[model samples]
Target: MAPKPTSSIRSFASSDRFLAEIATDARRPGYVLAGDESFLYQRCRAGVLAELAPPDQRDFCLHDLDLAEVPIFDVLDRAQTPSLMVPFQVLFVRGLKTLYGRGQKKEEFAAIDAYFRRPNPSALIIFVADHLSIPTDLRRMDMQDKERFERIRETLGDWCGIVELSRVDEGDAARWLAAEAVTRNTQIHPDAARELVDALGADMMLIASEFEKLALYAQGKQLFLIPPQHDQAQPVADIPTPTITLGDVETMVLAAKQRSLYELTDAISAKDRPRALALLHGLLNASDGGEDSAIGHLYMLARTFRQMLIILEKNVRDSRAIWSVLWHGFRMPPFAAEDLIRQARRYKSRADLTRALRLIARADLEIRSSPPDKRLVLERLILALASEPKPAASGSFHQFAIDL
Candidate 1:
């Protein structure tokens, strides 16, 4: 017997499964979408809206409410009342965290339980708990989010179906990129898909947006086709398929930003503190969230340092060798292979790279603690990483000095 295909072996994304469920139209009276993955959240929302509220009858059938502005009782009342203009109603409720705020929500829970007992046959309610962030791997979910997830299960899960919208895995994201390209009458080169996913850190929204630009770029490219040879009666012509290459991604996507990231790493590796700080400021200024994006910058920094550690441990000397060392979904873009190898060589040993990762982790914790000045924390981290290691002391204190 032949082996099973990869798609068959791997579980489908939660968002995809939810979309399929929406197509059947055999949904429950209410549901709770649990996660902060906006990409998957939007996908599920679009699927629900497309099924429940067609463009022609959207205004009459669809309703958007927030618990922060409107009370749950009013929302339940809206759901209970039937609309004269439309046959069915769909309510999207946001700010679910407000329900679990201070004090016991006995009245609110009672109202919800009573409403669900005899729900209107013509209406559907969807509660969006976007405040909880769910990672691709459930085992690694944050403790607070895990608690929040369980709380919902204990309460709302009794009356509503819970659909998790977790982050997409890198491999799944890349496969989706290829399949999505095919839907656009274009083929995405495997390398291009990998590069795109790695570059965006498997952010589906960014991948989807960049893929649109890539598809358009591929479609608009001038095709060079050879004329079919003259035949006696009729000629068979071969049509060429448009393909999105890696070069296209590097040209169209946020390649400049990635390049700046590499440049920052380069400065750090070379022990140039001034240049590294300058590059850091440039990165922050160019970002949409300014200092708020410090976490994202720290994430990328940690990833690059980890890559350098692997390169150092494997003794990878060139780009060709680097591929064999770095596994798929963890590899960097081809353009940075040589630069990374050079940077990795600058470190005296794996200890140096490990120290860098440790410093990054400290900075991450500080930023998460809601520091008054996130920029200063990042600057201190950079300064620490770019500084030369202290010379080892002779005697019993040598190990202690190295630990410091």
Candidate 2:
């Protein structure tokens, strides 16, 4: 009998839906799963394999070919040839691009194009690429490489069922976390879900792993809140939860509060010199106190000020415009983005933000140069940046603030 026609390309936001449809059902003859997010693709691939055959049967039916090392023709030949004992065979081929670069061998491309036209009835061939799509920046690739990538997509489009498994944004991430918590027989507060999404950024696999830890932690517990001390009958302890809260997130999930980073930025914006210096000191001293610690502080502070400069130059009047810039440019969470927008208004002009970045860069360089007193250099830099400037710039001030 002739094989079934290949299904049209379908996109999945998460692995759960894909597993429910593909893994649990009769396996298709061919699949082309492509994405830049390697971890998500890997998880989906594992799910596919688990449902394809049993552990013992996998040895006989399964074939993994690293196309980086294996020839395309060899992969095709094995996929076409049926296994004697197994009713169905699975061929996993990776690294579709040829050895030299993104371009494909004409012969190999033709071979794959042909196979997709008339795929094997009993074999399930999967072409997986962690970097199937190119970056949106056209300048990053040459004309030849672009054509090569286009050819690859065209070839895959001809025969295989293509699916895009891209990363999720903050809102989607929050919903996914809530659903995940429910599956684990627990619940995550809406605020707490947003907090988790913001803290972890957009790595779904990392989020999944962290969620598992939280699930285990909250397995048999119920959510509770501590009453105000004056209202409380006694001092409350042992906060347990099936419903995870923001406090639970800080204590259990996050190693350090990301909000503190924004708080430090807030202090700098308020132009409260003493408070800014003290906050900077506390930040450097947190986790592990050393020269290396001060180095990251320099980078982070410089980045924050640069962002503030962007906001200042753009004349962002509303939170919506601020969010648009941050979400698109920096992938910053909505809550933090709003906070930054509010703070950016505090800066009078571009020069103020520029001056702050200059001070941070000087401190960063000194830290890297292995100065004897790294802490003193950092403190001096912080004081200079946070403090109001005098009408007449001092010689010592210029000495401390090297020309950037």
Candidate achieving the largest TM-score = 1
Model 1 pairs whose backbones collide: none
TM-score of each: 0.64, 0.63
Q: What lDDT would each prediction earn against the true structure?
A: 0.83, 0.67
Where is model 2 more than 4 Å wrong at Cα?
1-26, 57-60, 84-87, 97-104, 132-153, 217-241, 252-256, 274-384, 388-404
Q: Write the per-residue lDDT of candidate 1 for residues 1-404, one digit (tens) a residue.
A: 11112242122455556666655756788989998777777767877877778888988899999999999999999999999999999999999999999989999999999999999989999999999988888998889999999999999888898998888888888888777776788999999998888888677788888999989888777243434464536633675677899878877787536888999999999999999999888887666544558988999899999999999999999887898889987888767899999999999887778778878988899999988888888888888888886756767542422333
Of the candidates shown, which would achieve the greatest lDDT relative to the real structure? 1
Question: Alpha-carbon error at 401 in model 1, in Å?
Answer: 28
- Residue-wise C-alpha lDDT for candidate 2, range 178-215, written one tens digit per residue: 76676676888888777777777656676777778777
Give the residue spans of candidate 1 off by over 4 A. Answer: 1-12, 223-239, 255-257, 260-264, 271-404
- What lDDT is reached at residue 201 by model 1? 67
